[model samples]
Target: MDTSNEPHIAHKSHLPHPYDQDISHVLRHLSRITATGRKKLANSLSTAGYLAAGMWLIERNLGPDAARSACASGSRRSLERPLLGFLSQRAVAAAVAENPPPFPSRGGVPRLRTTWRSQSDFIADLINFAMWPTNYHPGYLEQRAVTTKRLVVGEDFVRAVHETAYLHTAESVRMPSVRLSLALMVLADGDDRVQRVLTDTYRGYLSSWKQVYAEVLRARGLRLRAGLGLDDLANALSAATDGVILRSIGDPHAGVVDRGRERTLMGTVALAVMHGFLEPAEDSDGLTLEQAVHARLGRPRPSGATRSDALRGERNPNP
Candidate 1:
């Protein structure tokens, strides 16, 4: 195949320009490349090395010898820019797909099974899907935290927080997409267009989380500590989650916990942060924090059960 007429091929296909043309064909071809080459791109030491590996993959898949010669003959820069664009777009798509907005209703019918009882449950479900994106089925996970008479920050809440941490830790360790997107962001440094896309995606991510946080708090009749704004809490949690995930990537053992442990590193940190920011609604029935949590979990409190036992995961009345 004559590769010099790549732009002409796009024009003939009625695409606007080579850079603006649909690159799904390129993506398909790239997908056929060996896993080792894709891994090389992810582990590349520099942007130039990453682009070089990408070009090699393109040449290998697009055409055997002709594409290589053409790529070497003063077309490298032209192809490199578009290839980077394609990658940036993919990174944005992956981010969006990973953090879909929760849908509470479908065709005017409420989704009861997916309804969340608290912010912890909502975030736990989010982490589950984020960790295993392949398992997420649209409409199956539509979740909305329902309004309740009182928000109990008790047993279910603590368990959900721990589960979120465990799943997110596993995601950081196992998801190649997360690492690859981080690599792309690093490579996109100083590139205004790519940076803009990343910035917009991040803003969207924060906005979605903030909305959820605000809604869940209001619905539960809860309030933040004095001088703590909703955006501040949301941003802090987002930053903390990102930091923990990055740490998990660097040290997988950071998320490790003993069997039957109730909290991972992330869960412990998140629980502390939540305690600092959140306060019970001003109303009747002033119960201790441990009591509230246990009551919400609906576990029959054993005689002589203490706060220490509750925190230690010994809530079983019969046991």
Candidate 2:
């Protein structure tokens, strides 16, 4: 039978031409996923490959090859089953790549037990981790990365704080859009797994701030105020940062900082609010927190106070 004009014949003719478009689509999608995500997708592909092997066997025995002549028939039968299997596996790979799974831990949330060198060091590390591009993947996996990152980010934010006051002139703020957006979606969708991870992440992050604040107070020989705690300060800082990140992502002109004043103004205002709550530690020329506070508040200096007395809260009687 003549099959020259047949659809199957036409399809077989084009088979040797290569499906560049389909290959490009898969490559493009893979590029958007993280290295970790790609690993997960590769595992999925392995599983799908096994399944496809079984289907290929069944196709060889009883598929449409029986209806055509040997020349046209064998080619279609040899190619069609594997092609279908490949496409199916590709689809599965794409899905897995886009949504990599979270890591499982027996413990509640991982915490960093080591001490930070200083508050500045702690803040710098936190900023670097949070602002990194690696943590910005748009998936549950991204949330997991943040959860782990926060274990090190150590937590706490506040709006009525002066920390954000310096943020007005800050040049660039990094917002991990993919991770933050996933967090928002997880919270909205009520994904309990991601939510639990996020909670643990925050806890670990807040704990670090407590340590930082304690060290800061100790260096100045000052006590925490009766009504305040390290956790409170950390909470305020965290809130301010989250707010700024959200605002930055929502604004249409958020990336216009270089060429446009309006966008720069918007960024300044957002960053200012963030900075007010996250007051970076100041180097106060060898003064203690008590002395600094007293000076700022216009109170009389403690009688016979030395630098040691200022740091120790009271003069050493032996000296």
Candidate 3:
């Protein structure tokens, strides 16, 4: 792939001339996914999201060959088995757009950046802390040499590290394609603690694009004490997910309890579907995900709200 043709932002839609054509191929692929497919996309997301993300680290820092080798590890094998949930999330987003009553538009979902951000580093800190209950991943882990000229950390771990980020940009930035990447990583073993924290902490965020998930709040750099309001357009989905969890505790397929990594990834796609994180449709409303995100920015978060927070400390609050 030509780096020159790559869209600058993951899940991005806007592009300069000529390069725009490459984006079109991807966007068109997204538009074709069906409602059932979206549902599957959501459910299929798992460790793969993080694993694929790790690949991004290689692409940007280590070169593609090293990244491919990492994918063949025991970690990568784990993600392969649980892809349906991730796919479900993708299906749901597309389905939601099919319904116009709640959303403003239904076309042109935006692109997502595959690489984990500095916020990823923060989550990793928390994860490493949680894993040992009182330890870090060692500076060496974060500073591993991926290439002669570049150093690498678990930057891609953020993809499966939490669904909070996906929920953060859900309504305005639907990108189920990346959810496939997330599932792949979740299957891999980049960071297990990150998975646990997100599952336990952000349960309610899975509801809809409206209410803020607690973990995502923390991820966005909001202090635990800060108060965040719900998005009016998305409150219903939030409640719905909450209801399913409550009712699903005893059901066989939907209610059965999952253990270990399976336990944390449980209901991931189900919630994504309820929340509206699917791809966009053509000729629907021309509402690209980028527009939704831009519209979200137009409406201010609380006065104390901050955007794009980076991790600074290595202390694990959970520890």
**How does candidate 1 fare on TM-score?**
0.42
Q: Which ten residues in a row have the lowest lDDT in candidate 2?
A: 103-112
Better of 1 and 2 by TM-score: 1
**Pairs of colliding residues, candidate 1:** 154-293
Score residue 212 of candidate 3 by CA lDDT: 30
**lDDT tens readout by residue for model 2, 146-170:** 4333333434222212222223212
Best by lDDT: 1
Model 2 lDDT, full chain set: 0.35
TM-scores, in order shown?
A: 0.42, 0.32, 0.19
Instruction: TM-score winner between 1 and 3, please give it.
Output: 1
Pick by TM-score: which candidate is best?
Answer: 1
- Encode model 3's per-residue lDDT on 1-319: one tens digit a residue: 2222223323212322222222211111121246554333222222112222322332332221222323345675543332333223333234333432212112221321122223333233222222221122234223222211121122343343233322322211122222222333455355554454445333433352223333333333322111213342244444444343333332435533333223322235434532333222221222333443443454555565443211111122134
Where does candidate 3 stray beyond 4 Å?
Answer: 1-237, 252-256, 262-267, 270-319
lDDT of 2 at 179: 31
How many clashes (backbone N, Cα, C below 3 Å) per candidate? 1, 22, 73
